[model samples]
Target: MPSISQLRKEEQALHALLFTQAQYKNYIPVKSDSLLQIAEAYYRTSSDSLHKAWTLFYLAQYYRDSDEKEKALSYFQQANIASRNIENNQFKFLLNLHWANLLSDEDAENKGIEKYQTANKYAILLKDTLKQIDLYGQWGWCCLLTGKYDCADSLFNMGLKLSTSSKMTYYNYLLNCLSLTARERKDYKRALELVNRSLSLAKDSTELYPLWNNKGEILLEMNQYDSAHFYLSKDTRDYDPYFKATHYLNWSIYEEKIKNLPKALEY
Candidate 1:
């Protein structure tokens, strides 16, 4: 039989792997089924409430990423219940933040906003500026999707004000959100400028695709069909469903503009 120390070490290692993958958008090296089994085993064996809560949280994240929404919600509820006895404010904040994300994806934007507000209280308590910035960005995106352009503008600007050169990624993300808000408000020039600034901060081609797609959308709205096509085409190979959908929608519009009705319909 494994010693308690050995079991704890294994659980900690599994937690580190899941946490890194969840936080950084990195590809998981282990197979999902294998990871799930290990996490479940840890959850079953751990005597610590905090460890159980952490395991459940990661299990929720895995299910969420896999689009098993019902399972994810169940795990999140379990995690929340398990965490009630703990005093970890940072963990509480992260839990609420991710729960908000899931809610938002489920079209419960108002509920998500409430969760974000709850998370923000913890963020304030912890004095985690980076986490606060991330919350603002995510909250602003929800507002943008709900057509609350002014609200989004306010949230993104607030985040931008707190960001600096050291946090270029957050700064760039805010710029992108602000650009979308500008576009929604019919300020095409401002939208273009903000997205261009985001593009300037992009570190690699993977980051560039979405920026190019946004630029293409702005150009499409400006009636610059050729420029829109040039930029939009750059994202054709991107496999993300959201990006692909946006590309198809914009491409349809471009085709329509060029009087290719069949092509537009095909897109």
Candidate 2:
């Protein structure tokens, strides 16, 4: 059996590993496997309920990131059950937030919305303005997925109103959501305007890539082939896989717009 000190060290190491993975937005399969092993071991051996809850939470996040939905949901439920005796509102808020995010996919959006509302209550009790803003943004996205444009618009604007100069990233995210809402409404002009605003706030190429993709997609929708090609051609090799997929999908559409079926297929 690992000593308490050893368990603590392992838990801290897990936290650092998770933070690094999140910050870089890159997942190495080998590293993730190792992380899972450590988390599983810790969970089995640790006597501390809170630490066990955290371990289960990390396991849930790992499965979530890997798109193993059933495993993720099971671990989330276990984590929530473990956390029931703890007094960590912040952890609970994060737990529910992520749970909601995962559930927001496809058929479970209403359940996700309920979880987000629960998270919102915890956010209120914690009195964390930034967290509240983030919750509103995520909740808006859930609403958007559920085809509740009005609800999404209202939630996004609520976050926007709470944003400040120091919170430019969150502000930019809100603008992106608003742009999506505008696009959904077929208000291409407003969508373009909102995305342009987001672009102006971008500090680097990493930030600019997705915005460029967004602009390209909007222009494509507007039948502006030349403009769409211009934005879509910007290099996005550094983007993560999901964004890269979106970029290529948009590029394909641009090629099709010019009746270059071969080029579209190549993209």
Candidate 3:
């Protein structure tokens, strides 16, 4: 409930905190202590009704990606509380979307789908088409995860078309979603084609991580082990090492295909 000037200052501080946090995010062993310091800084300085809400959203996503589900959920709730205090429908929708996706337990898929729908509606009302497409993509993935292939396919198609149209900015997201849909359909050739398109577009942006990962996955599915290895190896060392586990898993399958049981086992 601070004045507009106070709100602007709080928003600026939150933005600065996000900028600093981005520097350490690509590392697998992300410095959690550093992240905690940033969160604490924001908590101390945030005075506006919405600033803390926005800050919590980013913190929740960071924890979610770091595999700290409990912490993620806690911040997500805090974000909701802050958003409610400000009557900020946009932030509320966004926070709900995040909380929905983070609740990935088997029992949570239905609730997640419901929240995604609600978020999508609010995003549309706000004339935030880009976020709507992104939400659709996330919702599609949720459907896919829940074994609702038809629903997932429909949602992805909508998102892809929207992204490919006027908002050509998010074309990479569209391509990635298409690749995911193709993979789900077992259309390895189409998946490879989609990933190739993504890589071409990603070369012009900072979204190289998804480009490399999708290409490697498609090559792995195509049984192109050596080629897959080359793609994965080209990724920056700062990229998560857990993805290396995927490379090894694909190599194991390749060894099996070549009738090298011992090598496969070793892999």
Best by TM-score: 2
What is the C-alpha local distance difference test score of each model? 0.83, 0.81, 0.72
Clashes of each: 0, 0, 0
The candidate maximizing lDDT is 1
lDDT of 2 at 96: 96
Q: Write the residue-wise lDDT of candidate 3 on 7-125 in tens digits.
A: 55446465455654465455434445454455546665556666667667777877887788888888887777777758677776777787878774434777777778778877877
Model 3 clash pairs? none
Q: TM-score-based ranking, best first? A: 2, 1, 3
Model 1 lDDT, residue 175, Cα = 92
Which RMSD values do the candidates have, in order? 3.9, 3.9, 5.9
TM-score of each: 0.82, 0.83, 0.69
Residue 78, model 2: lDDT of: 91
Model 2 Cα shift for residue 129 (angstroms): 1.4
Among all windows of 10 consecutive residues in model 2, the one with the lowest summed lDDT is 23-32
Better of 2 and 3 by TM-score: 2
